[model samples]
Target: MMICEINSHSLPVRPRPVQGEATIGFLMRVALANGYETPRQLWIGLRTFDAVCKALCLSAEEENTLFGPFPSYWGHNDFKYGLTAADFNHSLMRWCPLCLRESAHLRGQWMLKLCCVCSRHSIRLLDRCPICGSTQRLERANFDRCICGAWFANAQYVDTDVESVVRITQTLEASIFDKVALPSLPSLSAQEWLRLISYLGQFSETFQPAKPGKIANTHQLDTAMSLMFNIGWLLDSWPENFHVILETIQRKEAAKLSIRRTFGSMYRVLYVDLAEGCFQFLRDEFERYLHEYWRGVVSKRNKAFKPETVATHPRVTLKQAAQKTGVAPAIVSHIMQSELIPYGLVDLPSGRKVRSIHKSNLAQIKALMNGCMAIGEAATLLALPECRVRELISSGIITPLISRVHDKSAAWLIAKQQVQRLFFTSSEPRNVFSAITVRRLLKYWHLRDGEFMALVQALSESRLVPVALQSTPVSLGNVTLDEQEARKWLEEVRFQVGSSMSVDEAAKRLCLKQQVVYDLVRRGLLVTIEDKLPGRRVMRTSLEDFQATYISLAEFSRSLQRAPRWVLKKLHVPPISGPLIDGSRQYFFRRSDVCSEALRVD
Candidate 1:
């Protein structure tokens, strides 16, 4: 193993010896592909993580904080992030080489691990317990020791801490390849040469080219790479037939590159050429983050905030309420019928079937199940439909599938498939008859026998009693306003008089004002005058007539080059003024009198 000094720390790195004829022959025999070789530098970090925190050095604290303390990596597929020794042999063993080495080291440190049954462990991402559902704890065997008190065979254990193991693997490989250059091996004996040839054959058959290639085949490629590296490690020098192998791999890689380029170009043309698509992409990502952050903040706020009075809000349906309480739909349904909690549910209309039940009901189910349950029975007990129950099978949408049920009404089962379909298919549209269209037709006929007959005749001519779906009037979800609502809506007009405007607040409520509003009141426009506010009166003056005839006193005098008749009369007839009695000018004339007495015409 080669070591590199990083930050004053000696770290094991990858090994790459100088090239030679025998090694080149081996690589040629294996048909080593070029694209398959992702540069070691690309994976330095992942390899380092594994090297620094190998199984031998890993403590419970380190396992939990750094590498996965458990037997599996948390977020990726079994083999992703890193590899291990076992990963090379079994598809199920997901470890990468670097990860495998580190994991081995980690197990050596732990020495002994609790068994699956005794430790009460399950797969890291699994919701359903693998063994003894009642006991949710199951642990893995340590590198050197098993839960059965037996020493580990060859001290070999697969470490699920992917990232750390990957780092270590890369670090080791880098140091070995770049810093430590071992000399080429001498010709091997016939038996040894045959074995090496056989291994090379296997490696070539399994070789996978990565990048710009099919992503689905990544696992296969990863496996081949692991095997190749192992063989390379046994050989002292670099492979010589690299040129031919690299060329073959390059052809495949080129195909992938072309495909990637074509699709990328198409996407750019569709989204970026004509608009600000790059900005939109950034905006969308930002908005998504903002929404996530806000949602967390809201949840925290809701938990922290308290109110003096708790509203007795109606319960929403199980389908709608599942997201809020973090409870499965089956559990929610089971609680709905749960009499043990002495709780009742109320259904509230939110344009959907929503019902809410007390949280205590759920506690009862958990107690009965003893913490966990099998997949099938949990759904049965929850009284959920079979389809709905199956949908949650992955994350255990429902915690404890009820195995036994004494009461038919109390227990429900929702199929796991059904819930998946419901959630995934929410965007689909549903078919429904439009009642508004029928109502409009009824009004058009007005219950008149002749009109109804005419309509029937039209339908009959179209070869139907009821209109054909394609021919049916589309529903608008609305109707023309009726007289009462129309009148009420029209009552908010304001009338300008001098510097101020006049409006009837009551008339405003009626949606009318000024002369039209006043006229309506005078002609009993409203249902009743007693309904009007006190001191308010209606008058009769069409707005058109009023605007044409009326002018301010000052404007009228200016137009005539003399005071208006009413103003002159008002000056001649003085009014009294006092604290008790307000002072005012009084003048009046009929339209006929003004027409006859006015000497000038404008």
Candidate 2:
């Protein structure tokens, strides 16, 4: 249509960029002065004008000031500012009636999500038209009137104490736009304040009442501003004030969940460098609560909040170190106990002691472990009995490079090179075989599986191999075996099957389920002796005594003519005074007690 001269002084309004005016707001003023109907039309016209000019005359800084304000000022690449017409309501634009009446223009500050109340007038910003009860769209034909033909200048206002919010907004703006230091909030720099408010705004949006669209309500805006203000106040006093806030919110479950979720979000956002001054109060509280709640929830999944002891030599706790090394906490503890990786004990202010390792040592630990394998892993790789592997270690044929933790059953780390050397150069011609292979060999030799296993147990108990090199006392279902050695032993020795057997074998002999036998042993009705090779051993006499002296709950119920479930319910309430049977799952009663209780119930 018609072209207007393109200079700041030549424009009709010559409106200077106000302190809080967003670039889009300034563009809106330009469209109005140029007699355009809407901001959308203005955008189209500008694109067409740029085409005619052959090159976009707007400098990079100028274009950024207009459309890039939100993302650029917030310092986040992924955050969408929603400056276009489709996202107009997402920003929750608002205005003060008094300010509009005085200046006859919208300020950029009013477009911010955190700008809820007018600092100058001490009143809440009105986003919806009071007369028609519709959200003011601001794209209307005129500046001071709504789409429904209501004048915003005439809307009612309510008094509010938004001084703190106003101060925070002003401080953030000065710090971000002007690069000025905020002397009042000395603990946080300008960038930190921006990040803090950004987080607060995102959190506040979650509290908004359910609505039809993505736009937030005015009340939601007020709540967000209040939250940000209170957070700013808390920062003045730091961790002490933070604890007070936590105590106050503990009674409110929704608030507590929200705060906990927010802490997790902060951890993700802040990443691994959580220092003393970075959101001092929030960071401290985050770490404290994280330590308390970490076991089942965040400990395994999150690694962002690991505290750094020093800048040059950063240290991580045992749990964190384990996570970095991709191993278990017990393994890390064992490594520290053996002095393989140097570590120190830190006494916390809460009177708790924690073992911490330097981050630089993580690579060293990984390298050391890489060259070695645990005893079980080595056994699997070499296809040898775990017991035979231990024998080699004891005989000094394969010396373990790392020792086990004292009083703990954690496996020792042995150099893989030594094991390989022993396997290749040994005169015995060792043949690594799995349990399946051992079973085949037993079949080939015409020996029964039970009798051969019993002989192996006797050999294990004869103190021929040190306890450290013994096959683990647990089941040998997954154990690797030395086939040549096992074949030689079977050919050389003749052994007798014992009168007693393992719990599983006992269950089969007594014509009862395995769990039933375990229940009897748990309740002290049947006694067991601990054996090094095959774990718990049960005597035939003990099983016979249990069969004679104790009765099942079902039998007891039938004897008393009562329902089994009813009897079980009564027994569970005030539980019997003895060790729990089946870890509190099944309860056993002596036949005499069962008879007396049955009679009493009858």
Candidate 3:
């Protein structure tokens, strides 16, 4: 028939193309209008539907709009738009009975993987014939009739809560057509949204419960949609809520194993363009779970550092050696400075000379340097003044393996075990006190100056033996104690008092200022007992409590034997209730916190 004659003979009941209708669906409608038995019959040849459109008096733009694939129809180049012929299944066409009854045609949106529900009727689309349970075919002349001779228009329709489905549809439509600006998710672009949808589909297929074989129908689409909805919520809040989901997933052992088996790693599941924000979130989540959940699965083998054998003298640069040995570059430099490792400047092809160490000597140097400390480091480790350490060295009490620098100074590398041995050997007597205690005892005894001087002179010559002090800095001087014989004489001379004492007595016992004791009481840090005569007296038990619970930050750093900045950086301070002490921002850490931190540092 002539094109003009065919146009005149076109069916009077030609329906307008529905929004987001598939090319196949539109072709089917045109076929029905032109008295064709089926859409396939209207095709002149493979992929040639121009003849049918020309005969029907359809314009080029209208024909292209109705039948063109993605980029032309959806205004995007990506096949993820779900417009290709392969995207639809001729043997398994899904349809909403209510939608078909109202529009008398199928929509292109229904053919997409994302299209799980009918937005108009708020009902799930069915793929199988309701009565016979046979999958519906799309080749039928009429869009509403099933292969089983069932008219789906008369089939019972079930209502559904299509809120998620509606949202998914709107988001997909907005992304595809650039319809509306989604301010909530400003980081997402149209392409990224499309990729996210594609990823959801792939992820659902990978992790979904295994059946006998692959089935592409409403069930698969529903699972993908459900996953997309949940993932959408996760992406909305990102890492915080995402971390919660990961924790939950990790708790279910079976699910965790399934996920690992299916995806292998989180990175595999989230592979996408690095520029995408979703990619970063997924990567961070993956890394977090990698450490927390998949640590056991990861290989822990150390990579050996091997220098190139091409050179006559095989050597590695300081930075390269550091990386290979898993040691910091600064530490490696210190080792070189100490002359523990033989190093020299090597000429590079770039005409620059760089310091390098021979590979053969690295092992011996690393072993010698391991758990060893320098003179200053040893003093800090031993909690003694550097001068005291020097005196001990001079007296041959603490011997060190000294490495001589380039005719400048020697780097004393003391073995940590030796330092520990010497530190623990000289134990301080808990009852022993400094010279201040002798004066207090003399005053308590009501001794006269001449008697005290004669007693002090005698005690200084005989009973006053030097002892290694605890807590106090060496600059303050070593602690001196009365000999065992002198202790018996002192007991007979001075009266023993109860544990609870006055603030002045507490200050002498604690080696702190009386004003400091009063300040502690004022700050509610030190418990005190009320006394009408002495004003307020701090109990000895309260002093002991203060000693046990709190220590000045400086003392804390000394105990740790690390720099003040290092201590502050490592300490994770717990929330405290009250305001800090006035004047200086002097921190007083809980003794328990210090002990725990010490253990961690060690």
| Candidate 2 structure lDDT | 0.54
Task: Give the Cα lDDT of each candidate.
Answer: 0.30, 0.54, 0.54
Off-target runs (Cα >4 Å) in candidate 1 are 1-138, 141-150, 153-240, 247-602
Residue pairs with backbone atoms closer than 3 Å in model 2 (clashes):
20-108, 20-109, 21-108, 22-108, 383-432, 390-469
Q: What is the C-alpha lDDT profile of model 3 across 1-602, one tens digit per residue?
A: 33222343344455556556666677667667766666665553312444444445666556545522321221232343334443344344678888777767777666655556676677777877788977665665666776677888777876665465456556655555553333344445445554555543333212433221223452344654665555455554555555664554444333321234433333344542233555454554555554444312221221111122122224566887787777767667766665656776434456754566766767855665587788888777755557656755664455554533322334666655546544221235456443333324443545432444344344445444334445442321222344454444543233233334567766666666677666667777878888654567766567778988887666778876888777766878641212243642445668787777776665
Candidate 3: segments with Cα more than 4 A from true spot? 1-16, 44-47, 64-91, 147-149, 179-194, 201-241, 248-263, 272-281, 284-602
User: By descending lDDT, how would the candidates be arranged?
Assistant: 3, 2, 1
Task: State the lDDT at 429 in candidate 1.
Answer: 32
Worst 10 residues of 1 by lDDT: 111-120
TM accuracy, model 1: 0.16
Local error of candidate 1 at residue 341 (angstroms): 96
lDDT of 1 by residue, 1-602 (tens): 23233331232332221121111111111111211122132123233334423412444453333211222221222321232322221121121123223333221111111100101111111112223222111222122233345332222233333332232232323332233222443333222222232233222323522322212322242433343343443332233332233233334332221212322322232233322332233223222332322111112222211221112222233554455556667655654553323333322233333344443344444454344444445434433434434433333333323323423434443333322221111112334333223235454523322333332333324322232224423221121223332222223212222111123543443333344345443433232222233454333233333334433334446556766665555443222221222321222223344444455343
